[model samples]
Target: MYDNYAKVIVKGSPITKSNFKLFNVNGRAILPMNSGKYHDRYAIYEEEIAFNARSQNPSKVLDEALIAVLKVYYKSEKRHPDTNNITKSIFDGIEKSGLIINDAQIRRLIIEEFYDKENPRFELELFGESSFSMDYSIKPREILEEKITYNPPSNKKKALNDRMNISAIKPKISDNICEVCGKGTCKENLISANKGKTLICRTCFKKLF
Candidate 1:
């Protein structure tokens, strides 16, 4: 679930970073330059991508971690470009459009390829990472009931049953023991650590420091 999301479709034949021409300077060193036919094609492609992203009208540049899903369609099956190159182009375009502060903010990326003879383009989706949440609370009874109702003779069902059994018997940290040393201790003497997820005795705490 994402609070900030945007979808943009960029129509064009995707290009890769490998297309940048390399030049030799006095035969001393090689440098990559964004000049020539490849540069022209990539410039147009990036421009189109920026236009599509701007059409969505993002209020401000997003600086938070983001997830990007890219679907690339090629005009012909014979033409195959490196997915990483296309992804780089898309990210630069999105940044240029002021949709995101920088491409480095993208933490997760998914790319899928397909052939579309009629229309070749890139379908892009961006999601803010702040919207992601993790739920650790478990209800064994509810989970068991759901599993039993589905009752598929699969390994997944077996795994779920095992997990339920483990959860049911798992001891609480308030069991009057030092989890680190596996020794009995008074509950009051046990200090909470790791945001109360773990309980350790004062002796262990001193040793740790």
Candidate 2:
């Protein structure tokens, strides 16, 4: 029942995101960077996948939760990349291509691995969840605009009273009011002035100093 779907095929040896080398810095072991080979391969793979995804000509990026089915083909069966790592690279490429807002939008993912002697590639299929009805008329940009332009109702009086109550409950050095501006001051912000005889807020203290 998933009518909304898009397919992308990236031709090349699929790369995984988990390949990294460990190094010791200042007597502490750290594995902070990916291997040079992985970095270079991933860069090219991501670019190719983005191009393929854009070529699909999807009406708009799917905003709702999605289901991804990934088929990873390797040149040899002796070495196989981690399924999760492959999925990560694909999701990142899809996001970079603007096929979706973010990879977190994918709620379900399915992956399969195979060996191809001549042709090694990644085949990806994305679909809206069967339970939800996807509206092709609403673009992801429009959805973002709706969210950004939305303004929630605010009660200024209630907010002011809440702040006043919070300030009242806090410990104070003096009267909890700034001497110079007569604004509310907390204990942490109050500074002693005139040989501990008067207290002033940090702003007034800075001005005097």
Candidate 3:
């Protein structure tokens, strides 16, 4: 059933894994988060796991509903909507719902899905190595605070200075390497404007064209 949804998303148009694209993590399936940050905006697809209204009819009704929702998604995103008998109405829920994703993948998907730079301007920090800054942009603030704590008074001032220092600068996204080739470039090198993770440089990018 779920495969059906993936099928719709993959087969709706002339696009496929090679040409078709969807915002996804390097090693994960499913689009990360298109729900946006708005409180009320959301996807209307419904994937029902259990039902009591009659099995056969329910599945058919669900298929129709899912198809209708996918139609809306395809039109808005200009990409195909993947739906199947097993596809849920909405992938994630509120609070923790609506596109369950980690910080690294979320940032990667964000740059891939939204960043409007004509030329890909930046990349996300995927690897946290010694002597380098942590992926502060996508890394949750709560986690950071927990790891580094300062005493009050003099230490407090030192902490503020350090924290401000990190926030003041633009992030270097050379952290997230390309899963395909394992060699990642700085943010200025990526090209995600088209769609999906089908990333490539200008030279390689033209070859596809």
Candidate 4:
């Protein structure tokens, strides 16, 4: 297992043995495991920072679905939405479209399963577990957060994902209502949100935004 960590990291994944670890069978010594079966990882998290089209706010997943709907409605197989250029007009289209899932529980389905890299087209299965992801990688929000340093990606799709971050943020207009109050916007009401949409109250938007 130690060798596996070395080999895997040696192959790639700069995670050192110290970084890629779990308790050993004896339950005291920490050792690196290669199975990559960490449950907390690949699972949606309360404090987990999501940084992509398929992440950020759970409801934002609908934005992706609407994009697909636009492609179909327009009868085009190739579409590249300038998320950097989303306007109130585009948002209205998403809100009016029947494909939108307003409920939070269904959110995991859309982001985790439906819009995933493997399944780009819509596939709404009733009984299935959500896709697993890790919080370790900073690639998702690497550009947005200034404190961290990031190395750019070489893969074509990853390069695309890396480039299109939620840059179209609008400042909060309301102070009384928590920006994320009714929405499943944050881990808890502990936050509203500010991925650039939905006016987040000053209190909620301050820390993360």
Best-matching candidate per TM-score? 1
What would the TM-scores of all predictions be?
0.53, 0.51, 0.18, 0.15
The C-alpha RMSD in Å for every predicted model, in order, reads: 15.6, 16.7, 26.5, 27.0
Give the lowest summed-lDDT range of ten residues in model 1.
142-151
TM-score of 4: 0.15
Quality of model 1 by C-alpha lDDT: 0.75
lDDT tens per residue, model 1, 1-209: 34477788877677764555345666632223345555566666677778889887556567788888889999876656767777877898799899888999888887888888888888888787787532344455644443323354586889989999998876655476887898877677789988988889999989998
Q: Using alpha carbons, what is the TM-score of model 3?
A: 0.18
Query: Model 2 misses residue 193 by how many Å?
Result: 82
Per-residue C-alpha lDDT of model 4 across residues 1-209, encoded as one tens digit per residue: 11101000001011112222355677773432235565333122111211222231233233121112111011122332332232222222223332234322232222221122332322122111233222333357635664634444366768566556533342332333455544333333343335635555445556656
Which residues of candidate 4, in runs, are more than 4 Å off? 1-88, 103-129, 132-209
Task: Give the clashing residue pairs of candidate 2, or none.
Answer: none
lDDT tens per residue, model 2, 1-209: 24457788988888865564244766653333245554556566767777788777455577778877788899977666766778877887788888888999888776778879799998888888855443424345534443323222366767877889988886864467777878776778887778977768898878976
Model 4 alpha-carbon miss at residue 134, Å: 6.6
